[model samples]
Target: MASGNMTRQPSPPRVFVDVDVQRDFCDETGALYVKGSPNALFRRLTEHAVARGIPIVGSVDSHAWDAWEFGSNDMPAPEGGKPGFPDHCVKGTPGWLKVEGTLPPRFRFIPNVPHAPIDTAVRELATGQTHGVYFEKEVYSLFANSVAEGFLRELSAALGGAPEFVVYGVATDYCVRAAALGLVQRGYRTTLLTDAVAGITEAGVAAALGEMQAAGVALTTASAVLG
Candidate 1:
């Protein structure tokens, strides 16, 4: 028996965090394509989320022509001066665009700028007017965008609680790993869809999985998640 005055509590949010699933990483002809990555699986995940009305948060590597991370540049690499990567995902390029079906019809792109205002971003997302929210990043981690953390925090509060993040995307060893670990570190319950992600090498993927598992990120497959 229920009391007439009793009210139901709002359910905690569950969001899908799509990490760097752009043409450069997932398509065969792109500059930095990850060979043997299950790109179709990425599309399936996105479709499922849209059908279920789950919020989709994503990141894109929006680099410049002479960005320091490019191997063509003489500037030091982001990771301890190591050699940089081949040119890929340059701003306004075809390869920088999100793969077909991964982007929602109603989406907002958050630029990577210092001290960007987050109030409007949070309101737009929390109000259900925007189905997808994307963060343009200059580095492997979306956290590199100054407003990302603040936007997420405020979005969580607006939605009543922190989200349980379902993460999947390209290059399991890099952006996916960073996003998963960062979410967990920021007190979100994060889960990685293993089968849906593609990596540069088997060794790198295995190492990344181990590291993610050690840091309390749960791992599963697309089949498990979508089913």
Candidate 2:
């Protein structure tokens, strides 16, 4: 079952990738809890994929103590983890683990695999030679860090030279949307798994979908992504 807007281009293998599904992103006790996050349904969707022997790629929203960069449209940097939202997944803490319910026993966790090294992982994933890349990001989108030439080149390679990409994750408008559009600009076929994502606010969720469509990122449901 191909998800999102099925591209005419060849399938890039069954890479079941999840972005920032960490305590700081998808968990209810996360630093910045989205409105409907920690959603049971989203977890179930992931569980379904993993149970089917799909190579699961789980991303954690990892951050260093002093790693505050720019802020998202909605979430600003915390005075500390406590002051902003909730004390949460600092790098190397228990809170940094993936959201429990969505994970499978076979799900592989890759921490801070610098974007430079992602190309080989992506090639292996595309060839069904390995599980997909478990991508992490400190801020919004993984692609936002364009200055890293190594990362940029790797991303270009992972996208399989396609004109569009499909993405889904926590905080749709802020993080997920940024990643999707970023891929779009990089000339990848872009889409969003609408039902699988949640936002920190109702307005943000609506805004994300609207903007995604406006930017030519197809809006789709989990069924589309998973089926």
Candidate 3:
């Protein structure tokens, strides 16, 4: 995906947190498809970003094959994965790749690998390659990544005042919920783009959204945020 004619980050530019819009979570053929999610809407959201020059912090889940999630080596369930969970997003595999068009070429990308020295998020944002920081996460929330606080701090210091992270993506009940609430907890005014995210279950989505609202996470739509 190319971000055509997209430049000039918005003043008090909005930080878009794209959480786990990966093949494994959005594709029916994937190992952990999120019930009814399709990548179609995410593609539209990507186009909206390119048109709006909104820098996106794209996050992906990268797991090593030996990760306990796969039940490899008799290891207990991976820290973030559950027992009996099908092996998905294994490092260097197609399933590990971002969902189609979610990662525009102009966006910086990071794969959250386990035990990798240095925070991939900090390194990517520090490079200034793109206004957006795309990094990997080993856990459900970006905060679970070692450099999460640092990454948020970098954005805040660079942008002046804390950057408001406009978040969206798959599994609204889980990763999306965690990211939104975590951002709020970190003191960043976080907004969860309602329509941009999909969930594993309707009941779960409702519950998560309710919790996020109570936690002070602004629930809005992409149109409202991007406009």
Candidate 4:
């Protein structure tokens, strides 16, 4: 369903979108750790959201051992390749868990599977019973998940209007950048929390933040989130 079909109270003014805050990316000993813990701020955001009564939706990267992002793949064709990053967030592993202090009871998960029935998810979301969807992605952009744009459409409905997303998490240069840009492309307003996110390198983070600003994604700090 399109966003207009759902009936509900107007959503809270802010929507907290927590991107891959997984152990594999946020933990100190992770296979592909980002340099810091956004989870500490992420936890505060979750509690803040609850205080304001807003929803917190989290996205995770659930990949096969042979996912294109990994170097350990020994498979063939579409499923096997690498962009030169080390293996991380492999499916069915503890390393893939959301980092400590990030998975509060307020959050809802939408795992990245190869397939998700968008229409069904939309219907469920429209019922006003779900807090949020935990989208999963094999690709960097969460928008590339199996639910595709339908997730946003439904999410808008669930929130009772178009969403104004406050996004944070992981390496500032790659997945986080892709997700922020994707949200803009899909016609949503986005805000990136600087203090709550980390990067692979200082240069990379600066470049990514510059790019996001140029693309109209508001650059702000976690402290700025009043909720």
Please report, in order, the local distance difference test score of every candidate based on alpha carbons: 0.83, 0.57, 0.73, 0.73
- Where's the lowest-lDDT run of ten residues in candidate 3? 120-129
Pairs of residues at least 3 apart in sequence or in different chains that clash in candidate 1: none
Local accuracy of candidate 3 as per-residue lDDT tens digits, 1-227: 22356465667767778888888988888988987674777777776766666657767887777766564456675354456567888867998888877776555554454444434444444334454565677667877766556667766665566677888888899889988998898788888888888897889999999999999998788777656
How far off is residue 13 in model 1, in Å?
2.1
- Model 2 over residues 44-145: C-alpha lDDT tens digits? 766655444344444556666545442322344455452333445577886677677765543334445443445555444443344345555556676533
Per-residue lDDT over 58-159 for candidate 4, one digit per residue giving the tens place of the 0 to 100 score: 678888877766666644446444465688888789888887766655334555555656655554444534445578777778877766577676767756
> What ranges in model 2 sit over 4 Å off?
1-17, 44-59, 69-87, 101-116, 145-164
Off by over 4 Å in 3: 1-9, 71-73, 77-82, 111-128
Report the C-alpha displacement of residue 170, candidate 1, in angstroms. 1.6
lDDT of 1 by residue, 117-190 (tens): 76876776676566679999988897988889888888888778867788999789999999999999999899
lDDT of 2 at 43: 75
TM values, all candidates: 0.91, 0.69, 0.84, 0.83
Clashing residue pairs in candidate 3 (N, C-alpha, C atoms within 3 angstroms): 112-136
* C-alpha lDDT (0 to 100) for residue 175 of candidate 3: 88
Q: RMSD of model 1, in Å? A: 5.1
Q: List ranges where model 1 is wrong by over 4 Å.
A: 1-10, 78-82
